[model samples]
Target: MTPAPALTLARRQALINRTDMAGPGRLRLVNAAGQSLVSIELDQPCGTVDATGVALTDTEFAQVTTTGEVAGALLEDAAGERLATFTAGLASTIPAPELPLPAAQLYAGAFVRLIGAHIVCD
Candidate 1:
């Protein structure tokens, strides 16, 4: 398996917010290859992230959960598995660890961006 990336990568990835394609009030996690990995359902008036999705796992399958609040938002799985580390609104250039990016980890980084946060995927 490949390792994940640092938190800052979330702000760096190419993000395409196609809420129209994703239906109403939704955000997508897509790859460079244009694969929509996951879709998060959001209620605009509520001011929170609420959705559960079936995402591909190393073995078979897993549920991707999203939750948002005034403090912060979270995207995680049943086992409390997190794809990246996240912090909101990165102001400066945060250094990235010198490593290779595998496809799965890249998606993890995007998940952080979907939640509108700076992320770390250690």
Candidate 2:
């Protein structure tokens, strides 16, 4: 089998930097049906990019608009253009993961917070 191509630290930083340039992005938590349950505006400048990738700034609690089990996450730029999609899971299940919610089940009218979200280019 062919080995997968690897990216240098500089290359990874460059890619993340480009995405961060779209600053003030949005993080959307969605259900299995692809319906948004909560939408939070990321910090201006979004995050810091380094050899490891981007470590997103913590987000304020955003009210849940819909109730369901979180199945995935979507990252969008300031203009609402999608930048990436991530698999959602509990924190105990993954490493340097995305969408690691405290609970899988969220209800409308409740608030959710996103903390320590990191994105890697690998």
Candidate 3:
């Protein structure tokens, strides 16, 4: 067996480009059972790829529609097609370098805000 080669920054950027080709994207916060908590519209072009990976644009506040513990996130195209999924949690609990939420506990009608988040590729 052979080990797979790690992706270079350029390669990572290329992958991101393809995923974001549809322009503008959405980040849907979901619970362990895969129920959506809230869906926030991302900026057109979504983010810029660089050494730090995909630097997501800050998003406007969106109201949470369901109450549950946020377990992960679904990245989707503007049309709601899934692009990727990533582990999610409170800023101090998530193992990933980015994709932090203000709190893991969410309730309907509560506003969720996303800021300084990124799709880090390593």
Candidate 4:
């Protein structure tokens, strides 16, 4: 597993958690090889790092559960370009909010990507 990167850009801390619709919604980044990356269980408006900069699918959201996984290509968007990392037998333990409360959910076989702070190019 890779280490947590330091927040360097202003947008790093500015990233807000995004939530998908309860019934159906887009997962964002998709793998061209046609494989499920991760799956996140959301019951309420769970905050997520949404890079698409698009509108939320549904404002009505819920909290994440331990049984869920965030499936999809975790990407790092830097300088307007999205980056992909190798997940070959690798698992990352992201710093989740906390236990015993409304927080993010993660499980085995979950896929994730790391994004940098800067969205602009030098």
Candidate 5:
């Protein structure tokens, strides 16, 4: 199957509802053209840059990668499948994850958060 055109990460400012303060909010990956790269649903964050990775539903899990300064994650589907990966523009050859993971998956947002907006509001 032909893969969807990959979009570069544009602003990691994920939306967090002020009302959902009680619970973890949803996050997404916006493209350079200002379009949502994928439809992400809420789930326990399944991403990390450390040595360990987060395990998703039944068997899905994310793989962590590093290049000294930058980090990335390879998203997996439930039943243990290699969907795609996100490398923080570190001159690596990691492809982006395919669209729409199950009902809910956590990879982009969880990893993106580590890079955040870079701007602090005092």
Candidate 6:
């Protein structure tokens, strides 16, 4: 049997993009009640810069929520190992802004290429 691929630190924000949120799709799984959830749309691609890059549009607000259950799900097991048991935390926008141009562009495209609107979980 093929070994299961090891999960890695993946950047997949496009999965939570606005367009995706606005359409019919899988309901985010939940393990708690009354948690906070937030999503943000940037005026320019906050993660991508350059002619080939994508900037977030300001027309929408970058959402922030107290609910972090969904965010917790996206994190790889290894990535979440350092976090405390509590799941309350804000998911930051794409990290590409903190990276160099080439890295940023690649990450930006990854962030925006999701089938629907992309969002950072918090």
Sort every candidate by TM-score, greatest first: 3, 2, 1, 5, 4, 6
Q: In lDDT terms, how accurate is model 3? A: 0.76
Q: What ranges in model 6 sit over 4 Å off?
A: 1-37, 41-49, 67-122
Q: Judged by TM-score, which candidate is best?
A: 3
After superposition, the stretches of candidate 2 with alpha carbons farther than 4 Å from their true spots are 1-23, 50-52, 94-98
Local accuracy by lDDT, each model: 0.29, 0.74, 0.76, 0.28, 0.28, 0.26
Which clashing pairs does model 1 show? 5-121, 6-120, 6-121, 7-119, 7-120, 85-119, 85-120, 86-119, 87-118
> Each candidate's TM vs. the true structure?
0.25, 0.76, 0.79, 0.22, 0.24, 0.20
Number of clashes in every candidate structure?
9, 0, 0, 19, 0, 24
lDDT of 6 at 34: 33
lDDT of 1 by residue, 1-122 (tens): 54344322332231112211233333333334434445454332212221211111112122333322111123333233333223322233234321112223332323432322222332
Error of 2 at 38 (Å): 0.6
Question: Is 3 or 6 the stronger prediction by lDDT?
Answer: 3
Residue 120 lDDT, candidate 4, scale 0-100? 17
lDDT of 4 by residue, 71-117 (tens): 33333232222233222221333432111112223444434332221
43 in model 3: Cα distance from truth in Å?
Answer: 0.6
The local lDDT score (0 to 100) that residue 68 gets in candidate 1 is 22
Model 6, range 5-101, lDDT digits (tens) per residue? 2211122234223223333222121124533233223232333322322232333323333423332222112222211112222224343221112
Candidate 6: worst 10 consecutive residues by lDDT?
A: 99-108
**True-structure RMSD, every candidate:** 16.0, 3.4, 3.0, 12.0, 15.6, 13.7
**Candidate 3, run of 10 with poorest lDDT:** 1-10
- RMSD after Cα superposition, model 5: 15.6
lDDT assessment of candidate 2: 0.74
